[model samples]
Target: MQKKTDFYFTYPPNLQELDLATMVSMYRDRGEPRKAAPGKYLACAVTHKLLKEAKWWFGLYYSQAAWDELLTKGSEGYPLTEAELNLLGLVLSSETPPHREYVEKNIGTLPKLAYLIVNDIKQFGFLQEDEHGYLRITPRGERALQGISRRIYQKRFTAEMLVVYHESEELHRDDDQRNDQATLF
Candidate 1:
């Protein structure tokens, strides 16, 4: 049997005044790339879950663009967490804007947890609140959920079901427009 390992994702090393988390948030939320040194990009949509993965960077030199291609857009990365997807699914299932109270009550997730997820959803422009304070799914949100559905429907017969990428890159170039749709391995 293969020795299976669980991998976690995080930002690349940022050789700057800002801390790693802040730098990463800026790059991820603003969609900007920063070059830490010549031929080495520190933070950007192009590179992610970086540096630490380089346990032995002796010969693991790659351009910023290439790194983005491998990690961010490559076979083993996804930008969204499961919580965000769940919230999106809830919103899509409703014919109208689902109230936040309803979502909280139905899911039984703590209000704080639900708030954070909804905040992330709003930040990504996936879902928006109507004037009446009900949560409505945006076109982008629909597309994200639909994209997953479509991919699963197409790959139903196959053994591949690990990766189902969100449709974010094509429309929003500034925030979370990364090429990573799903994980491959």
Candidate 2:
């Protein structure tokens, strides 16, 4: 007779606190276990454990008011530029497509505001352009506002925005330094 082997696995006690939904979302968001069928996503033990730890830091730093201020207002106590706030609010508040002329008149020229709105739409997956070329808020964007009230989604979005801003600033500084060195040479 041949002997049979069985595999066993154990999870850390701390991971028990992360509920199934959060785990599923974390896994899906990370795009792990590639090509997993719907309702069949399985996170590896290491990924599951790390998500458990990450949840703590999510709540530790991000607050609803802070993110709201960052979104509606700009960071560091500076109010969002009139164009920035207006453009964001217009799309978020209305499903109807406002005319391009109206947007340009009220929100300033497209060139002036396009970079901010375009970058936000790309990075956050919160806005989409309609077939008619009108912009609209996506389901994810609606979730962001809803989450703002609950404070969960708000934190994640705000953290992501901060990271992007910091990276852009660092890149700009590096470019400046390179230019200075070129001038010196």
Whole-model lDDT, model 1: 0.45
Give the per-residue lDDT of model 2 (tens digit) for 1-185: 11121111111224336665664443233311233345553233323421212211212221323323334312222223333334444566545765444444454323423343345543566556656657666676545443332222223233222222345578999999999999998
What lDDT does the true structure give each of the candidates? 0.45, 0.39
TM-score of each: 0.41, 0.29
Taking the tens digit of each residue's C-alpha lDDT, what string does model 1 give over 44-98? 2234434312221212333444444333211122333334445666676667778
Q: Pick by TM-score: which candidate is best?
A: 1
Question: After best superposition, candidate 2 residue 75: deviation in angstroms?
Answer: 12
Badly placed stretches (over 4 Å) of model 2 are 1-84, 99-101, 108-111, 143-185
User: Where does candidate 1 clash, by residue pair?
Assistant: 46-68, 165-181
